[model samples]
Target: MTTQFPTPANELDRILTLSDFNVDYSNFDDQFKDLAKLAASVAGTEISLVGLIDSYTQWIISGHGMEIQQTPREETVCQYTIMEEDHLEIENLSMDSRFQEKPFVTKDPNLRYYYGIPLKSEGHNIGTLCLLDRSAKKLAPEKTELLKIIAEEIVNRLKTYKTIELLRHKVTEVTDTKNKVVHDIRGPLGGIIGLAQIISEQGKDNNMDEVLEFINLIHKSGNSILELADEILSAEKKTTVKVKGDELNLRVFREKLEKLYVPQAKIKGIKFTVSISPETETVPFPKNKLLQITGNLISNAIKFTPQGGNVQVNLVLTARENPNVLRISVTDSGSGLTQSQIDNIIEGTSTSTEGTDGEAGYGFGLALVKHLIDGLRGSFNITSDQAGATFEVILPQ
Candidate 1:
């Protein structure tokens, strides 16, 4: 029996005029290859392919038992398969007018039976996972389900690739903004510092109260500008970890946090203390990330704690059947967070509240802290009671 598949002239025209879609498939690592092999194994097919369709060709990103890397779009049976909104299985393409004359059917791979599952992302159909056999055959229901599972995996991988690309663009933008800020501030800051030095020298023999005030103003302005530059620099650096479960010395980390926040705490008339169980000191973590996490917590604790209040940090290590873990907590004696604030922290939103001294924040620090913790595959939580709020981080060793 001969079947005539509907070929819409307008659709053909659009496809013909469309420019070639260029994607950097080389960036996809061994996962694609593994998926292709697994798909073929699960389907019990001789050939399996993870292919991407451009305007004029279908490029095979990864294939099992297939030497042909690409074929003309007009000749790829998978092209016809993707046109439909469902997974397709054709018992014999040679009996179908739409694919019988295609080069892939008569030439290289000598395809006969074809089953394709569309790979889609963000509502756009990008490619397909297909199994091909040299002879006409039908896939069992279980095999068909397995093929669809593999297709979903391919779609997930594409989504991940797109996410990484977006993050790279954002990182570049942040770095550019940081450089511009530094470049613009350096000139004015140097001038102020130089003029202040000159004024101090010239007023050496006079009562010089006005001169001294002017010099102090300039000095303070320079210091503020320097601090702003440092924050921008820190923000521009990529906070990614290549290795997980690397041990960090919690003892030294807590000491550094104490020293950094003590002066600020004292200024607010707040008492700061650190308490840890013996085993917590050698908690495994990516280096420097502990600093980022602890810095945000300690800074927030000091910023929000009221006068004559106290802020205490505690660390405890525990061993479980799954893995060893460390739990770090920062407790503050402040007005305490609202339920909404706790929800926002857990939900990863930009919810900011004024500090005791009306200090303002850009709502970026906690978001950055959350992002860093997620990167380390850790968990964070915020809890509050009558006394205050406690921020906790649980990290796998």
Candidate 2:
């Protein structure tokens, strides 16, 4: 019996627009091309591709060892490979019954070995990063693991590209809003200046009531300008400012955790939890800085933790310390940061890398967190291993 040609679900429509992104990395991006090269080289394969598939075509976005840019979906192995949640590898394609009849096999090149992982991002199966070999072979467990990481890196790059595109769109919107706000401000400013000038010029001989009317008009116009400025400034603040606190301590944290990240964590299958052992209830710390420090750390934790993984937020009192301190910690069961990343982040020399979910972030969040900690006269430390990572902030009471 002839098998049905497999295709991606409805999500294909949303992510298959390869041209819509218009990604340009001269020749090709170092990361994708490098990953492809590394994958093939490590696995001892001759061909590798970073690709996406539509109903009928597999578009090769990046890779090596293939002359053609695309192939018919029905004739491609990726169509079936993409169905797996993690990865799919065929030790020898000719020996596999499901793919034995495939054209890429029976036809020229007669590809014999294959390894690939599905690129799932934002709840959609976007594509695959795959290795192909003319000779039959099987990748060692370690090599297969490397392929998985490379696939994740490719997905992270895609996510970052998409995020940058979104930010570009947002910047355009902000520019338009700024222009509109400036236009609006001019009318009120002009009114205030005109009325003030009129009151000054005609004040000596004019009726007193008429002067008061001019003054009132000027006041209203001034108020209008202030309102506009405040609104613009407030909107700008929301983008970077997590929260503002006055007389804030660990008490506000559990509430903030519930209000801010709990819902987000639930959506991602991250077990977000909080623990608090307050020291004297309320300590004087810059609320904004405290929020920035902890917020960025927790955000990182959640971003790096895979679904069903754990992320913990803990606030502990260290009474034994000379100053009697409060330590806030965020830990995650995800891929940990490298030593280089840790050094760069702490020394303000480098930014962040990709998270497990492929979320794009300015490597600056941790730096900003450190800056905030310093501003608050607090100390912090970060440590990570293959299993996970942790960040801790200690503020004096």
- Which pairs clash in the backbone of model 2? 352-363
* Candidate 2, superposed: residue stretches over 4 Å from native: 1-3, 8-31, 94-103, 106-108, 122-124, 196-397
Model 1, residue 350: displacement in angstroms?
47
Candidate 1 per-residue C-alpha lDDT over 1-397 given as tens digits, one digit per residue, 9 for 90 to 100: 2223322233322322211121343334365889998988988889988887643246677888785555534456776766767788999988988788877788867889899987765444567899998899988998888788788888777666556646655665675676887978878888887877777777667678887887878888887887787777665443321222222456655665665556657767899998877754544443335655665687778768888999998877675536767778999998888898888877777545556775443344566567667866999989898799999998875
Worst 10 residues of 1 by lDDT: 13-22
List where candidate 1 sits over 4 angstroms from the true fold.
1-22, 207-397
Displacement of residue 378 (Cα, Å) in model 1 is 43
Q: Using Cα atoms with residue i matched to residue i, what is each candidate's TM-score against the true structure?
A: 0.48, 0.45
lDDT of 1 at 342: 85
lDDT of 1 at 290: 67
